[model samples]
Target: MNELGLNFLDLGDSDKLPIILIHGMALDQTMWTPQIPVLKEHYRVLTYDIRGHGLSEVGDAQYTYKMFADDLKSLMDYLEMDQAVLCGLSMGRAIVLRAYDMYPHRIKAMILSDARSEADSNETKYWRENSIESIKKDGLENFADELVGNIFCQFQFQEASGSGGVNSKHRLIIFIRGISQPLSSSQMMHDKIVNSEFKIIPKAGHMSNLENLEEFNHNLLEFLGKIEF
Candidate 1:
């Protein structure tokens, strides 16, 4: 654990450039279980639980993407890493983008899976408010099904924000999306990052990396191989 009390695992050669994996909301670093062993063979890997999730300490302050990005930067500082490739899944994508926006020099590249680049709509805001109210009223476990249903079944995830500062020319970005999920957002991101590569994982849903580990890992490794790093 670092000074922020975040539970993290740093694996592979310390001499190699690192690849940091950021999991989605409601998920811990363990979600990257399948990819860890494979990735560790080539580069240093870092996986950590976001604040308030898994074993990470949750402070009294309200959580925001900016804060999460700060935590990521702080973790890098603690590890004495000057730069690393960032791989984010779902809500993790937002955190990655925010981090790049704030500290572009620290990010060597980006791998965004199941990403979204749009601002949240009013309906999304309403649903988020309703979900919070429901969770508070009935507790997390009781509202789990409903929350998951809305996010997965209905495909109503909170959209991303603060992407205007990300410039495509300076970095190599890879976009990975599930074949079953909506592709518009991924396409938008791909278009935004002209030099970025995009891949679709077959027979996968929102959680593409977990649902189709083989294909996901293949794409990841391919990207890693292509990069100069």
Candidate 2:
């Protein structure tokens, strides 16, 4: 893991083709743990924390999808990645969409998971505002604990509940630990989430990757496989 310019976790053989993985808001590179082993078997996997979320330096500028997209582009340029498949979840997906819109030639294909392109509904926006307030008031630690429980399906929750029922709890602990650091500026991210123009994954909430991992991964791999390398 390097945090010099952009905080990233580089895994697998560097000589292999590059694949960039972008995590959603309130999440860091660890979100790709499930996919890393599978992906690294075929390509060089690079997972990074977006600015303000992980070990990356929280810049003075407000967060925006365009800024996030620019960061990815800059990272790719810095690393000399000519073109690579960009896979993102939630906010990460928005970043990739903006990146494609800004620099289409730099991206070969994209995997958008559990994310939306359109702005959130008034209800959803209210929820986000409440969430932001909760995070600010009670801190991310407690908020993360409450947040992860709502991410999975009831069936999944039941299964987890049956097996000593701590997966979600454990995952939340890890997630909260990662994001417990101070935020740079969430105003841009908050605004973007509230007033996004595109909503790609209508069925998914925030944690679409985990809720529908199989389907999501299948769609992602299929898209990547179809791309002409």
Q: What is the C-alpha lDDT profile of model 1 across 49-96, one tens digit per residue?
A: 999888999899988899999999999999999999999998899999
Give candidates' CA RMSD values in order: 4.2, 12.4
Residue-level lDDT for 21 in candidate 2: 88
- Model 1: lDDT of residue 42: 90
Per-residue lDDT over 1-229 for candidate 2, one digit per residue giving the tens place of the 0 to 100 score: 4434678877777777677988876779988887787778878888888988878888788777788888898888777788877777656766776777788777765554554435656997698779878999999999889877665445456545011211221111001101211222222232333321122222333554555456445555555554455
Clash number for each model: 0, 7
Model 1 weakest 10-residue run by lDDT: 151-160
lDDT score at residue 155, model 2, on the 0-100 scale: 44
Q: What are the Cα lDDT values of the candidates?
A: 0.86, 0.61
User: Candidate 1 clashing pairs?
Assistant: none
Worst 10 residues of 2 by lDDT: 169-178
Candidate 2 colliding pairs: 116-199, 117-198, 117-199, 117-200, 118-198, 118-199, 119-196
